[model samples]
Target: MANHGPSYGLSRELEKKNQARFSLDEAIEVLLWVENVTQLPYSCDPTTCQNAADVADLLKDGVHLCKLINRLLNNGSRAPFNPKPKMPFQKMENISNFLEACKAYGVAEISCFQTVDLYENKQCYKVIECLRSLAAVQLIMSGFEMESIIWLWKLATSCEI
Candidate 1:
């Protein structure tokens, strides 16, 4: 039984719109909204409603995944969340290596590689950047703000007024 939840589908949809972009601030606002909504007592169980609290957790997890990607790009192979050095390889020198480390760190371990391969062509540095754009659009689209589509385009092109 595979979990083709909203987060999973949204991640894939975002990958297809790789060239798209959105305002980081607005994206954060939506994420906060998601968190608040999920915290409500009426929130449905994750097994039944993907958009329920599960989506919020997934969004937060996505951000954490991005942080790990950035850290790997900057720190040169060391796992950002792992401090014990218990793993055989401490550094992620390439995309495959980074994905493996992510699996070890339990970041969507089962589908982590699929997500990475979809956005990055073995480029660790670009992983977070790509994910950031994808996440922004996903959040905005979910918010039903069609007019903001132009805003996303502008943000992607220049991030300037």
Candidate 2:
């Protein structure tokens, strides 16, 4: 439970290796893509990470994540949950809800991440992978041909919110 970075320089090398997998740029792109697909009541900007505790801070509450799942699952017109989470446990519940929604939407279990990954600010790449997978699923369902899949992902990554 003590994931506040390396305790000392002894683990710095290992920490750096792990940090290399967390792509802040990719995370932002995923967040922006989710934002573009859903009709969020809140204007949670993904680019505010310069002051955020974690890249997933904007999604820490899990409200938008649920919305993203709802959108991906073709439930964009309705809310999967109604909790206005403020407590830590509530935030965790939202994350859990998002994961459940992912499973329901046919996302591979391997692509889904654990709650602590986002809640504790760890393993951000997992979150991005899940989001990208969801986006791909959404795009493919929307009639994108097989050849366009690669280009679609590149387009989504290059797109700005």
Error of 2 at 144 (Å): 1.7
- Model 1 TM-score, all chains together: 0.23
lDDT per residue (tens digit) for residues 55-120 in model 2: 667777888888777765655444356458768888888899888877777778888989988887
lDDT (Cα, tens digit) per residue for candidate 1, span 1-161: 12344445877777445424333344443444333333422233333433222333333223344343444343365533432222223312233444555554434443343433322222222343444444344434456443344434556567554
lDDT of every model, 2 decimals: 0.38, 0.71
**How many clashing residue pairs, candidate 2?**
0
Model 2 CA lDDT for position 88: 87
lDDT of 2: 0.71
Off by over 4 Å in 1: 1-16, 21-93, 110-126, 129-161
User: Which 10-residue span in candidate 1 carries the lowest summed lDDT?
Assistant: 116-125
Q: Mind sharing the TM-score for model 2?
A: 0.76
